[model samples]
Target chain A: MKIPILRLERILLVSIQVDLTDNDAMQFQSDLVEQVAEIEALGVAIDITALDVVDSYMARVINDTASMVRLLGAESVICGVQPFVALTLVEMGRDLLGADCAFNLGQGLEILRTRIATRGDTRLSEDENV
Target chain B: MRMSELPPAQIPLHETADVVTARRAARELCEQLGFGKADQTRLATAVSELTRNVIQYANHGECVIENRSTATHRCIWVQVRDQGAGIANLEQALTDGYSTSGGLGAGLPGTRRLVDQFHIESTPQGTCITIVLTKPL
Candidate 1:
């Protein structure tokens, strides 16, 4: 299934609600990159809270997706990684480098806001700046 | 020992879709066996890794899931076997950051850490890996 990527202001929010196969993940990478470039988004938040399993292939795909977003000049954060998935990723020795992580969507948005502000992006207004 | 009498559910691992099926089956069986959410997720993720390996390196394979229960303990056992080119270096395959497929090399070792018991037997003719996860009493 194709994952939905929602656009809010200058941020793209992606919530994965299925057990993604290798093909699904590959498609997601391309789709996300394309969307990020199309809208010129300043930040991306990928929420995997509904995912119960993350294998080596999926982990690598997540890392690659984050890198692709950064290369496109958009900051990305991986949000809502469950405790089990976190433990498995560590055990597998596959760290999601170059991608910021948060406990949940709220934290993820905060990080993205800070990053966008630091980069002098137009997403956050002066009144909302923290 | 008690579970030896029951037939194991066989899942064919021939493609990426099969890997997803296997993972789903594992989670269902884990839930049926009364494993907690964390344990269920752990088992399902381990199953995903092994089944993906079967499809990636071995071309095709099968995963057998069985329930094992004794007087004081109950657990699930999974066996993944493939008839293809076997791993050249078992130790190297188990090491993190060592991958022949340009991956993170976390499949085998990560699987081992997720379960309560792990064993492997490989040869040029085929390879068989077994893992067991026991429910805490």
Candidate 2:
């Protein structure tokens, strides 16, 4: 089934509550990317607190999704990774590379806000240079 | 241990749904055995990795979970068996970051780290991996 994506201001929030199959994961990636572009979102927050397990494939997909979001001009943050899932990912040597992480959704949104603000500063500087 | 004696719960690993089923069953068994939440999560994650491997590499397999009691301790024993192409280089396969399927190759070795006991026997005919996690008394 499709995981719901919510829009709050310039941020897109996706909370994965179900154990996603490969197909579900792939579909989520496509949907998130498309939604990010359609709304010109500034950031994406993916919460996986309800997910108990993340295999290698899922880890890769999460990383890829973060990269895809960045490619579409949005910052991405992964939130609510359980302690056991963190340990397993580390041990599996599948670090969620290139993806920013947060302890929970609140922190994730805060981080995204900070990152977007920083990006705004950089763009302002670039405009002044031009 | 003999499989016939254990009356184990069997989980067929054929697809992603089966992986979820195996992990859920493992979590229930851990709960019934009085495992803490962390321990329960560990078992569930390990089961997910092993069962997913069965589906990804072997295309089909089965996981057997049984409760075993010894004079000193009680433990849950799990066996995952697959009839498919066995690993040619067991050492490399067990190493971290060695995945033929573009995975991080952490499934088998990471599973070993999570449990108390681990054993494996693989050949061209099939592969059987067994692990045991004991309940602290």
Best by DockQ: 1
In TM-score terms, candidate 1 sits at: 0.91
**What DockQ does each prediction reach against the true complex?**
0.66, 0.49
lDDT for each residue of candidate 1 in A63-120, tens digit (9 for 90 to 100): 8899899999999999998898787677656573336799999999999998888888
- Candidate models: Cα lDDT each: 0.86, 0.83
Clashing residue pairs in candidate 1 are: none
Candidate 1, B86-122: lDDT as tens digits = 9899999988778888787778987888899999999
Task: Report the lDDT tens digits of candidate 2 across residue range B1-137.
Answer: 23225567998888878888888888888877777877787788788888888888899999998878565566888899999888788888788767788765677887788888889888988888998889755
> CAPRI band of model 2?
acceptable
lDDT of 2 by residue, A1-130 (tens): 9999998877899999998987799999999999999977889999999888776778888989999999999999999988878876675564644488999999999998889898873431223346
> Fraction of true contacts reproduced, model 1?
0.80
Q: What is the per-candidate TM-score for chain B?
A: 0.93, 0.91
